[model samples]
Target chain A: MESAIPLHLETPRTRHKRVPDDYQPPYPSFVARYKPSVNRVVMAYFGLQYRGTAAAAATDALAEIAARFAAEGGPSHWDRAQYVDQAGYENVVSVAYWDDIARFDKWFASAREAWTGAQPEGIGTFIEVLRPTVARHETLFSSLGRPEGVAAISGGMSGEVQEHAYWGGMRDRIPLSQTGPMSPGGNPELIRDGARLRVKAHDNLCLIRSGQDWSDTETSERKLYLDDVEPVLREGMDFLRDDGLGIGCYANRYMRVLAAGGDASEKSYGQSWWKSLAALERWAESHPSHVRIFGAAMKYLSTLGPSAKLRLYHEVTVAAADEQFFEYLNCHAKTGMLAAVETVAA
Target chain B: MESAIPLHLETPRTRHKRVPDDYQPPYPSFVARYKPSVNRVVMAYFGLQYRGTAAAAATDALAEIAARFAAEGGPSHWDRAQYVDQAGYENVVSVAYWDDIARFDKWFASAREAWTGAQPEGIGTFIEVLRPTVARHETLFSSLGRPEGVAAISGGMSGEVQEHAYWGGMRDRIPLSQTGPMSPGGNPELIRDGARLRVKAHDNLCLIRSGQDWSDTETSERKLYLDDVEPVLREGMDFLRDDGLGIGCYANRYMRVLAAGGDASEKSYGQSWWKSLAALERWAESHPSHVRIFGAAMKYLSTLGPSAKLRLYHEVTVAAADEQFFEYLNCHAKTGMLAAVETVAA
Candidate 1:
């Protein structure tokens, strides 16, 4: 496999992690667009916990995933676990760029045997996926090698890597662009509308990340990345990509800047929608995918010999309707969490 | 632990498995009875499946269960797996004699923590418990080790173990005994009147027995029983014992005959009840306890080298009320699968 076809971006200060407090984004937040051939992005965060025996299966699954990605005209774009280290969980969060959601869907629907066999029973596997335009989602990163996640996967991303100082300055310049969906009812020019919108009671907000200074060159660590990492990411993406399974979840996206480098991002967050808080809790604790991912993580972490930088943390957030803000700008059709909120749209 | 305290029944011919085709009990249909001390019997069937990784957990849990019984005064009378073996599963179905359901309930309610820790996430643990009197449920076999299931757990039972040939002769001499609850309505008459009685649609019937010639005292077999079997079994029993957690299950009881020797009870059956088929299915496929039991078995099975006489099979039965038959003799009140059924004293 060669980065020759199109490494697209120039590498800068060796793509490093930025402690959250010290981090800033230099790029203007806008509705991102892909090249003519690129139409959608597949993002995922596959995590691991360090305690149990099931975790090993996760790493093994990951390796199988990476190999698959590397084979035959694979994903147009892909990234590894470059996200910051949060306290609770170690995860492999990445993105794959594709021109058509259908092609990606086709592979997912047909490629069962190609990935890890029946998800390990003891492990936990939690996943999320999204196909949002630049206007629907926004991201920020500092000093990354070329582009990563959605930005990297999309062919037309301005491949320039910037410094932390540059990010600090850029933050003040770019007010966030619209990230919600284009309401079918058109724009609302309400000042003090008589009708009061009811705020919903449920939301799913997750901040997940791995340990500090944890990435090492040890044989196992390398194996974690090269073998187990990619396939697992693919599995997660495939999981969320399937429309049939995304029951309560509206949108699933993983942003590199949001997931990476900074200590703030070390405990990165996942923003998704659910019909109810109870529904979200159920999925979190017992969903097959979630349990499997958790199990695999535990198994893998257990093998790492203690003292290996490792702590995975999560602060789940459930919110009300009024508490969330989502919108889209000069972008295309449905996008973001709000697009799936039927009540608002109706 | 000493059998001196009215060890009750006599052991006959080292209770062993009888292949389905070869099994034939000659006693004319009759309900069994225990001495005055016997109030109810707790019967159970624990089984295994040979192919998967979780099978090891099943055997291990069984061993743990057997030890628990042996260490504590043991069941008043219990039998090793001796029921006829059908194709498909290996099971240990045995009974424990309980003079007072209260004592049994006390042990169950308080003895939870002493069992296995949080149920293993990978193994599959399924169990069934019945507290029935001699009138409600009857057992007829060629020979069985004394002290099986609830029969052994209780205070006293007839100290006679007879061969089927002897049973065949005994049948012509002994007439049918009472096999119904003492009616509060004070009528032996109501039952026999030729009035069409409606049969209920909800019922659960189980016939679990282990496989034939499947157990081998090989290294793998010993390791499996010692390491994986006990823990898995303990976990499952613990899971159901927890008042806060045993959601849909009514009761759980496991005895050696239902889980012991004779082909590892490879074709054991699990007889239990649920509010509905859907509820039972949900627990079987997704509950943490069930999954963990399955996983442990798989892991344990995978590790065993070949030449291990291992076979685990099961056919879980959920029946409609009319399809199941149960009764309570002059023995006690509120026992058997049909506990809610009205008691009628004959």
Candidate 2:
């Protein structure tokens, strides 16, 4: 939650990895861009694999939480997913994007009421956080109004820049500001009064991934889905969403791999963002949702015998929210990294 | 939860089904009994099918709850099980038996703190309840002390008349008496001041059955456990527990079927008790858990290409608490049906 040490310090938090020239877009589909007026971006996934009556409770809980978000205008972009896969385990997840870390923090603390309620008892759920910068991360979204993740709050912009791969090579993408001398180079005296974007020393970003697609029926892939996968992924998703909110998660989405690229076709992916590593780990290790879910899994594996198809995976990454450069090209105003292009580049 | 109707009125409740002559002890294992002096008994199972981090969370939650129960001095007997199957799915469950419905009722409410806390975003959770009487119900507990369900509170008794069944021959395990003429052979004067156990007129009992094992995977018994069934099962259980509670369900449990007599080896059952059929039906029909669980099952059936192994079944029974018979043999001092037999009969 607190800054992961300042960017000026020499640590993993400040380490900047230049984007690889061989890096192709992570998605096979066309991707849209969003720009917003914030130094940080947060993405998350809320998903579960379920059956029985509790599935409905999960959905109801999600609907209730969604309603709460809609009322509070919690995230800039919030999207729903029916059935999502976590490794081999089947699940449902929602992807949400937040432009303001402060707003996200505030919402996370006081919004307990949105998640406080009764839900079915056996669904498995967790939150994942992925902190992507313009350089290391790429996304593709449909133009359909169902804008997921960060696309909902972005506006259009275009420009180009040579330096700072972290800025992602948009035409006029620019950085938000913080006090003190900016990184890479000292403040541009010429741009001090100009519209140049700014940067902070210790902006923190996080990446989280967690979900299960198969359970006891995990020994064989075909039988896994045939026996364990829920035919209606949405039912499970709704159950998860309703229950997901009860535990604190900044934002999460259940994603189907329409284009697996090199990955398995049946595999589903989830993306989530959290304020810090501590917050994310605490929920995973100590919370009831995770504890009960994994507990059942261990018991299932022990009772039902070998299950090779069911699997769970996760990755965590943290970085400075704003890097040293920005370039907004054919992007929107609400998108992170280019959200305030005009205000900064001018 | 009020009673369905007054006990004085002639209804199905007042009707007694004499123990059948063909009846036999319900289990292959030897069973002991406890003679608690309470008319109404409450039993439940907390189970989930989960994997990865989520399973741990479920266990943690349960552990926390068990600790709370231990702290609160809950139930006469509370036990734990792992890899228990309910129907076809797999999970771990904690079976609890309460001798006093009044104490159970008190614990259900006002004990919110025990369940309140931060959990992961998506882990389906649910509660189920079932009501059964001596005639229709039977159990066997291992000498290992892992007492479950009704067996947790029952005691042994051997003295019997040729007319009574091992199912306690309580002259009226008869539904607990209301403030009226009692039941079929109403004669309050015979034992006006006897220290007999009593039950509330409207005290409701629920029977919930869920969780799957090899049934959904039975087409290829080898493939059953190979496929992931825990996710959906957990999802399903949570949906039921959450939605069930929202409705009139008093409690529920996810059970592992250790033995099913003549049935296939892999089968688990759930038990949930409800205040009234109407209350249960309302929640089942309109609540999110039932709708979504069934919907998910339908979708799962539709998607997996073949769902022959998957099956869902449940039974419902409503009855008065005290039965029409009671026989006190050599049993412990805490069994239901005759909690204070010595005190009352003396």
Q: For this target, which candidate reaches the highest lDDT against the unseen true structure?
A: 2
**A101-195: candidate 2 lDDT, tens digit per residue:** 66766775544323322234544443333435433333332122233345445443112212121111110111211111112211121112122
- TM-score, each model? 0.31, 0.24
Off by over 4 Å in 1: A1-219, A244-246, A258-271, A330-334, A342-346, B1-79, B82-94, B97-264, B268-346
lDDT for model 2: 0.38
lDDT of 1 by residue, B1-346 (tens): 1111122332221211111122222221221336746645544322222224545665565566666556553445544543211222333333343455665556543222222222333332222344544323333322233322333343333323232222111211111111111111210111222211111323333222211222444675766755776567556645543431234553333333334343444322233444432243334434556556645654555455334444332212233233333322121222222233344333
Candidate 1 residue lDDT tens string, A1-346: 1110122221332212111222222222222225645433444333322224555775676666666556654566654553212222344444344545666666544233333123555432332344432222333432233343455555443333332122111111111111111111212221211221212223222112111222333666757633654345334433532331244454443323223232334222233444433233334434445445544543455455443333222112222222333322111112233334443432
For model 1 the local lDDT of residue B111 reads 27
Tell me how much of the true interface, by contacts, candidate 2 captures: 0.00
